[model samples]
Each structure stands twice: as structure tokens, then as C-alpha cells.
Target: MGQLSRPIPLLLLFGVLVLAGCGALGPGFFADRSPRERVLLLDTPFYAQEDYQCGPAALAMLLAWNDEALSLPALSDQVYSPSLEGSLQPAMVAAARRHGYLVYPLDQPAALFAELAAGHPVLVLQNLGFSRLPRWHYAVVIGHDLARNRIFLHSGRQQAMEISARLFERTWARGGHWGVVVLPPDRLPATAGETPFLAAAAGLEQAGQWSAALLAYQAALERWPGSFGARVGLGNARYALADYELAQRAFRQALLLQPANGAVLNNLALALAAAGQRQEALVVIRQALELDGIWRQELLRTRQKIIADQP
Candidate 1:
């Protein structure tokens, strides 16, 4: 009997498991019928994937388009998973940051299309086989023709493979519709909201890319003036770079927005201490300690540092 004709209990069980796993996603795909038709075929370079090297290939394509010259083999060294015979998601994000690009996962189909419309190619994951027998593949979406219901991708050996939107959605749904976009430090993603953008910048800071994180924080401030989080992030990045005067200015601005925040006061005090204003730093640190919060230990440390700096 053919595979389809056989009563495969395993396949049925896998289908149930997949559905249950995706239950929290609520639903798949957009409900609107008339999505805006757009054709923004960005001049993004393409690289044919070799065996289980689609991750590196797709990442190379994105980095090349962002004006970084990197070979697939070099990227493979950074992201390739030897045991799994493929690349992991965290490795992909790390590789992008390593090449000085800001990478963020897209959560919505509309956001993916929005990035394409804004001349950014999106990398996505797809499962080409059944739920039980998965064939995971990575592809780059460069453009789409919504009127014809067709999407274009740089997949496998095809530089411009055209597939129906419905088919694309089905395959993408099997992989949880995972999508990501890479942006330069000064640039922002098309679907970038204030909160998520700030989070991405903070992630850069945590990754120890102080210069890139500083640029991202400055960009955030430009887009959202008086943003408390952006101000705090800017202060943190500047402090890391030893720009104490700028850090103090940014922390002071953040304090204005969120007065009584011990964390902000603590950071500001540290910046003041670093700038040689030991008396003022001691006063600020004392104020922070008086506030009942989780930053008491940090405030105490800053007080000790300020006292130590005094002659």
C-alpha cells in the first residue's frame, strides 16, 4: 500500500501534537481578504544553499544586502550546528550581531510584508515535509505580488522562485511562521515599535556591543524623544564607554521622566562619581538609598565608590 493509503497512526498523532503546540498562537495567517498588493523586489543578492547550509546562505544574502562582504563558509563557522546537521536560531541571531547588524524576530505576517515593502528582505523557516517527518528549510523572501497572490523567494537553487501565497502560508505555518530581518545600527525595522526597538537595543548592550548599542539608543531617542527607557539605555552605554558627562546628562533626563526610580538615581550617581563630582555623587546615592526599592545594594556600592574617590 502507498504511504497515503496506509492508516498511519503515527502521522495522526503527530498532527494532533503539532496543533496542540500551536494552540497558544491563537490562529494562523491574517484574516483580511484584501491585503495591499505590493511588488518590492529589493536588489538583494542571493546565494544557493549547499546541502544543510541554508542558514549560512540566507544569512550571507542578508548581510551582503546590508553592505557587509562575508562568505557562506565563514558564516557557517559561526552558526553551523554539527550535531543537528543544521543551524540553531540563537546562533543565527548571534552571527548577525557579530557582523555588526541588528537582528529582530518578526511576530506578524503583516510585519513581514511591511519589511519587504520597505526594501528589506526577510529570512523565514519552513517545514517542507509532514509534521512527523520534518524537512526544515531556511529561505529569504525578497518580494511579493499580492494581486496575483504570489510570493517570491531565494530558496535552494532558485534565485526567484514564485509560489502562491496560500501555499507559502501553509508551509510557513508548519514552522510557526518564524521570520527575521537584519538592519544596520542606524536603521530601524519597518514594524519597529518603541518598546520592542528599545528591547533590541538593550539586547545589543547586553551582548557587549557598546558602540552599536549606543547608536541604536541614539536612534531610539530620535524616533521617540523623552523616552525613559531610551534615556536609561543611552546612559548605560555611555557609562560603559567612559563618557561620564554624556551619561550623566542622559541619566538626568531619565530621572525627569521617572522621578523616584532608584535604579535611575543609582546610575546617575555612578556617572557623577566617575565625572569627579564626588560630593554631588554622594548626595545622589544617599537619595537613592532612601527610596524603598530593589536597588539598595547598587546604591550602597555607588556610595562607597564616591567616598573612595574623595581625597
Candidate 2:
């Protein structure tokens, strides 16, 4: 509990919780035993937590690594909840997005090591207490030493806190294995799949970050050229930026991947219409109309809009 500074009463409770929480390790640590003697120690920056500000402090570490100039206090104001005395996960994600970073969720414990190996610091949530009696804390995973069976973290009040990998898994599992790797939109997470990577980029789109979303989608396409979602998202991001011709190009490429896909068809038609290819837009929407799916209403709307558009 070196980094986990709490009230005296809570400190005493945490000591008992720690004793009670110790038990057998899960299969997760043993699942991927390869790369047996590897080690990666990132030069990640550290900012010690002030009370319940581990969330912001952890985020600051990641942003600093990315060379973003935001200070710790400013970050605290953005993510901290006065009533909750700490920050929520969603807020942490949103704050990262606001700073133009792609916040990718690391769903598995194995992903933490994978990302660290790839030189990305991972922000993780830990349950420092028992599940029923929870004391939530956030920290950054900067490196791993497999030979010594240790994982390094920038935790509360500790710049280089090391914990056993087995114990780390238990605490992380109790915290729902929640972690994220925050990086610029142009960089991809080491273990991110096509689906989740596209999903994270879509979040930037949803946030109205068209330029950032464009970069993210482009990065996704670079890694996964066959990803229909990346192609569609690239188109959507372009459309938002009023680059109708470029958007149409992306939609057309996406169509090649999955011809007769209603969503892609609708998007392509919309882009065509916006680019003033009204006749071609009408034809595309008509083809989409023949596909039997829930997008029928949406297709008809695009058709109607194209028909009513002035030549």
C-alpha cells in the first residue's frame, strides 16, 4: 500500500483485505509462457498520485509519454469527480480523446505485456482490496521482467513500483481486467484486433473529431487493409470534413470488400450524392434497396434526398 495512501481506518481495512485476498494464481499468467526471458523497460514518465487522483496521474503519465503538454492539475479537473472522490473509466477515456489520442481498451491481462513489449505504457485499474470490499486504484504498467516474474508500474506515490505478475493478475481480474493503452491516433495498439481498433476510431468519429478519426482509420487500414469498418469509417470521417470526393473513394473501396452490403451501399450513395454525382447516387441507392435488410428505410431516405437534389 506504499502508493495507496488512505485514511488510517481504511489503511487497516486494506491490510486485512490484502491478507484475505492472497490465494492461488489463475491460468492467465501461464497461458502464454513463450518469450520466456524477455524484458522491456520503457522510459515512461511518472507523476505520483495525490490522494484519490491516481486516475488523472496515470493518464498524465501516458500523455507525457506521447509528448502532450497538459499539466496534472488541468487533467485532474477534466476527469475527477468531486462527489465520487475519484475519476470514472468513461471520463478517463473521454479525456484521452479530447487530447487527440486513440484510447484502446486492453481487455485481457496478456494484452498488458504485449503492449509494454511494443513500447506503449498501459493504464490499468486495480482492486487493492477484496471484491466485496473494494478499494479501486489506477496505475500505469510501464514494463515487464519475465525472468524475474515481475511487472513494473507507476503507482500512487511510487515512481517504480514492482509487483509479482501472478498477484497483478488476481488484482486486475478482480478489477474486471480493465486497462487501456492511450496513444496518438496514428499509432496502433500492439494487440488490437481489427474490430476493436475500428471501434476505438469510431469513438473519435462519435466525438466529432473528424481529422483525428481520419488518421485513426487510415492507421487501421494500414494494419488491416481488408477491414470494411476501417474503409467505411475512413469514408465517414472524410464526409464529415466535406471531402466528398475522397469520402466516395473510400466508400467505393469498402464496397469491393463486401459488395451488396447495405450500410456500405448507403454510405457510398450518400457520398456520391454529396459529391454531386446525383444520377450515380440514385443508381447506388437503387441497388441498395434490392438488398433485404433493416437498412431499407435508410436507403429510401438517401434515394429521396438524391431525387430531390437540384441538378
- Error (Å) of candidate 1 at residue 218 is 1.6
Best by TM-score: 1
Deviation of model 1 at 237, angstroms: 1.6
Model 1 C-alpha lDDT per residue in residues 1-311, reported as the tens digit of each score = 11111111111211221101111221233335233476656588989988899889988999999889787788999998878888877788778887767877785678887888788899898888878898888899998776566788999889989987777887788877788888997798888887767766765765678799889889988999978888888888888888889988988998898778787887777777777777887788778777746767666766765676576
lDDT of 2 by residue, 109-220 (tens): 5677678778888888889899899888999887766667777889999987888889888888887888898989998888878777777777676566779999999999
Clashing pairs in model 2? 3-156
Local accuracy by lDDT, each model: 0.75, 0.77
Screening candidate 1 with a backbone cut-off below 3 angstroms (N, C-alpha, C), the clashing residue pairs are none
Let me know the TM-score candidate 2 reaches against the reference structure.
Answer: 0.85
**lDDT top scorer:** 2
lDDT score of residue 64 within candidate 1:
92
**Total clashing pairs for each candidate:** 0, 1
lDDT of model 2 at position 193:
83
Write down the RMSD of candidate 2 (Cα, Å). Answer: 11.6
Off by over 4 Å in 1: 1-36, 305-311
TM-score of each model, paired residue for residue: 0.85, 0.85
